[model samples]
Target: MPLILDALCLARDDAPVRRLIDALGTEPVETTERRIGEPAVLSQHLLFGSGGEIVLHDDAVVAVILHLAPTPSAPRGLDAAEWLPGVDNDATFADFKATFDVPWRFADGDRYFVLEAAYLRPEFVKHGGRRAGDLQRVAFTVDDPRETCRPADEDCPVCRELIVRTGDGSFDLDGTVDALVAGVEAGVLKESSGAVSLADLRLLHASALMERVESQVTCTACGRVACLTLYRDAPPTFGYHPLDAAMRRPLEAIPPVEEWGDAARIAEVRDAMRYVDHEPGLWFLVEQHGDLYLDSRYTISSMADDSCLIRLDEAERQEYHEAGRDSLTELARRIDRSGPHREASPFHRRNLLRHPDEGRDYSAEVRAAIAGHTWLARQKQAAAQRAQAGSAADG
Candidate 1:
């Protein structure tokens, strides 16, 4: 006799857990207090006649364990009068609450403000620690206030030279001989004349006198401090930094989870997942003739959405057998493509035979790679469609 067993762990009030229980329909037989070890990790669990158990950890429902077999030892006698007769419902852990609220996810210490790319709730505190409120509409602009601490002497040659040269409003000086001299005299270049070069000035503005402002906010409840940082008067080294939008865009506020419910939470999760780029299984995308092919050393396959599995060609298959020695005994030694057995050129599709065996079951590697590639392409297309829809709505 053979048996199939499956178990799923979930939060007490999770929707899926409720759905599974409702689907099973059968009433649990006995609810008992179970303990483990000497000091004992203790919990209450429900044992059903169907060989299923619902384990509750610390008043919060955690795991639903199920065991099924054609013939198996019976669980302890189902003698209890009621199944989960009394369950405590008031155990909402802080970590669980934080999962639904994005602001709470990043909050550290006593402050509760969100400053991420999507949402910007400037309010520094959760509403008396109950729930997050709407974003305060605070509008401000960034401009260099043009304040710099200078030596009391009005005619500092370095400052005068920099201002004169940059009078034409160009901050595009590479840290060459002239730039180095200005940096050294202005005390921005800490290392001696010989040590620092063009690389050292990579982070600094070329003209070197960029104005910046920094402000700190204290948490209303615990008096903890957080900084509100802004930059100004910086020249573009090559092109614009994508991070500049952090200041430019008005940050929206994430509402409390209780307000979002399941539907809205799923929407948020789906939106967030668009930004993730999962790595496909390790396999080379090779070009054979004019068509793209995927090979995982053990097997070769096509790049089409519905192509069937194909094993390595006869010549390459012979290489795999010969390189592994006549009996395949020296397999590991030959699999290391770094040594004398290495292929002459990596670009050629035939050179894919030099790749090490990835411990996959036959053509399973190619199958998984194709599946992942297909899924990634679908995700990108869907994200683009959503972006287009959003732009049209805004227009």
Candidate 2:
């Protein structure tokens, strides 16, 4: 008998793979390249000791196929249902065929158990295909407080009174309690007659902030907080951080300091600083006490006496910062300097034609460089438009 687990839809990450391997309790015995479909798409098939096989395409586990012995003899080898639940353990050959709609002709012993992907795949895809097992936080806002409150409880009197006075059971945690308290004081609701006081409810609501209503799990691969689940309607929703727009844009496309203002420029500089050690596109050159400190993705080096590149260690980096040098200002200046001629050589004589001390304000210089880059970009855009217009006229 054979068991087919279809449409796993597992992410192309190591987390799920590692979990699968652990659950199986054995490493893959052999791996072989297999081709399928009319177009002959390549896939990797991993064979396990338990007669279970996993098919992978683009590192995503798409299917798992396992072979089981005939029933009545207690079916030898691994049990697929133990790892993947909801599979029938005591199904007959006829039952398997009828359940899975197996089209092929088979002998009495050739039974098949098919575990459909619908049981697992939909939830995985719903949560942004993240390897995190399940949602940590699930919250919802209701239109009626009575919908969530117990009707038989001691607070029922107050709850009913609230529904009548407020015109509906809907609540605003901040303002509703005060209104309820006021109503009780005005003798509209009985607060002392075994009803839960509005003050106690207010205290309980405030204490909820300290309770663990949600959990956060950091992804081991990206070291980022995993996706969150929110319920705004009947079906739940999951969200991920928006794509990195700044990284996607070319450096020239970044708005100039004058357009973005001082606060925005400062924010950009700070954000870029975080990636200085990891982003190849970002670099910084700082001058401190006649020594030039060059920081890039690969290495942090210092140059003194206009020669001799010395790599800085952790201690040297700390000392450099403690020496009271204007690194931020210098970084802004360098960004300004590189904006116009990013593709050209940094040491090109034309690039260095303006002396380093020509601009006293580094922020102003950065603004000027950004302005120049913007002007050049506009000029190229205008030139492209003119060429396009000429082509249209010719056509």
Best candidate according to TM-score? 2
Q: Summarize candidate 2's per-residue lDDT along 298-390 as a digit string, tens digits.
A: 212333111111233355566557763354344434434444233453422223223334544433333332343344345456545644553
Tell me the TM-score of model 1. 0.16
| lDDT of residue 186 for candidate 2 | 65
lDDT of 1 by residue, 283-391 (tens): 3332323333333232122432111222345554466446632322222223223232224423232332333245434244434334434543554565456445544
Candidate 1 displacement at residue 84 in angstroms: 42
In candidate 2, position 379 carries an lDDT of: 43
lDDT of 1 at 273: 14
Clashing pairs in 2: none
List TM-score per model, in order: 0.16, 0.22
Q: How close is each model in CA RMSD to the real structure?
A: 27.6, 24.0
